[model samples]
Target: MSVQIQAEEQRYSRQQIRDLATELLINVGVREQFPTPLEEIIHYLGYTIEEFEPDDDTDRVSGAVNHRQQIIYINHQDAPRRQMFTLAHEIGHVFLHREQEANHIDYRDGAMTPREQEANHFAAELLMPENHFRHTWMTWEGEPELVAATYGVSAEAVRVRADILKLT
Candidate 1:
């Protein structure tokens, strides 16, 4: 089943977004894996990923998604981890907001509307699934850096996930 069918409307609670992300991961055959294979998942969902260099070096734009064309564009200058997050974030937009907009762009400014928040939550859950992340957190003794490395995400991302998960 497509992620779109799982949602009856555009507005979703955090739990609903998490469930959608988890369901997508399982549908893509990505259970119990660190650094979820976003590329493969995108392909499975019939989307393409393309990287483009920004005209300005200081551009804060992270990525954009064109749902009509099924293409996701990421800033080539971003670190691999950032690109991964952006990719996941775009995928979240694809599944969650496709009906709301034909295209969506993301910025690194940290300003989040409700839809952006839902997309961020989906990205976190997709990349670091709660069950696997919790087990890894315990295995790593609650060290965000180690968990981040294992998950192929930034230490800050790990810390944020830990905070969201209440991992102490």
Candidate 2:
């Protein structure tokens, strides 16, 4: 059976979310860079990654710190690219939402919530910085793969950014 997935209505600009992510990382002492050392930064925030079997009903999930525990769980039964996005998404919860109160984010089937959308934007901006992505793409003489590689993201991501930039 085929399923329908809805494209989320964006509530924040790429610039706004990027700025918030930058501020969060800076407050945590993560130096400005491509693919910021998220694991390390999260560690400093007193969170750890744990593994569990996939729910079959869900792609991956994350657990936030609750009570006095300092651990978060991420399901590894996913593609490398998806695993990367999931991890970034969890980091999104850590910075953008109430971690101490919320315990889990079952980011299954690209779920949508206002908060999840915010996190998605944060992840996209963090993975693909707008200014850097634009500058790098401008240098690209029309090579999508080249630009995607330079930014360590998927070609589709670069393609979307290009569309957003009105480059193609």
Candidate 3:
């Protein structure tokens, strides 16, 4: 496909993933509930969540989902918020990209593949739906840290959510 076509396809894929995430959140009662029980949702979906240290020579792989094993492995070195977010991101891949063979996402601060971006969007929606996030952002005096603490997510996540909801 041409670059424009590829971009359009990716955009469509990401939107579908977002819709799925929203549905899952609502089905699990997390969309209306603060501090979404994301871990519980992951377990409810029958995926195993595990932690491990990355080998010294390789890059810091934040999370990986092996479809054959139905397992998610999160890096132990990351903060709690990142770990949880990584798990959500991996969950996104399994559910949203079911046709793909497999892919391990690197949680680095740089360019991301279209699939990686989709997973990130999935994670964000899973953790903080835009409507709920905006309500919380407005009611909580716009304190990202306070909202983050309430949601058990990183303040940066809240900031990004705020920006997404155009609160920033």
Candidate 4:
């Protein structure tokens, strides 16, 4: 019921992971750098999304994905934007950590490894792509919150993306 990195068998650079995620979006016909329907992309990749409740003590586990079954579950209590991030993060694991996922490793250790960090980058990129984010920023005239609303992502995600894209 959990998808995890197995013993860190494969180490992917954050950039590599981000490239893969962008490639996936392109493969799914995302030709524009705009707010993509993260749910539709997940479904297109054969993933089904559901909402669940997590205990207050479990902040590390916001969401979980089972790629073999093509299912993703997000915490119901999380902010909508947080759930979006979790979904995109899980999508990162689907491609970046295929082997460990194929072996059915449950990533419940709550440790932040290169893989997890890469996944976070992937999530940020997927939710807010570089070029599209830049354009959106220009449209909003430097208001991150406005960009966040249009993209259905968090304001923090927008700012982080802005920093990554050197727009800040």
Better of 1 and 2 by TM-score: 1
Candidate 2: which pairs clash?
none
Clash list (residue pairs), candidate 4: 4-107
Q: What shift in Å separates residue 130 of candidate 1 from its native position after superposition?
A: 0.9
Tens digits of per-residue lDDT for model 1, 1-168: 456644434578878988898889889898667778998889998999989888775387899999999999999999999898889889998988888788988988857787888888889988898888999999999988899988888888888999988997
Clashes found in each candidate (C-alpha, N, C closer than 3 A): 0, 0, 0, 1
Q: Write the per-residue lDDT of candidate 3 for residues 64-157, one digit (tens) a residue.
A: 8887777888888899998877887888777766456454655556468777778888888888877777778888999999999877799998
lDDT of candidate 2 over 3-109, digit per residue (tens): 21222232566677889877776776754565556677668767787766766654445333332365666666665555555666677766666432346555565
Ranking by TM-score: 1, 3, 4, 2
Q: Kindly give the stretch of ten consecutive residues in candidate 4 with the minimal lDDT sum.
A: 99-108
lDDT (Cα, 0-100) at 21 in candidate 1: 89
Per-model TM-score on C-alpha atoms: 0.90, 0.71, 0.84, 0.80
Q: In order, what lDDT does every prediction score?
A: 0.86, 0.64, 0.77, 0.75
Q: Which model scores highest in lDDT? A: 1
How well does candidate 4 match the true structure in TM-score terms? 0.80
Decide which is better by lDDT, 2 or 4. 4
Alpha-carbon shift of residue 65 in model 1 (angstroms): 0.3
Q: Candidate 3 has which clashing residue pairs, if any? A: none
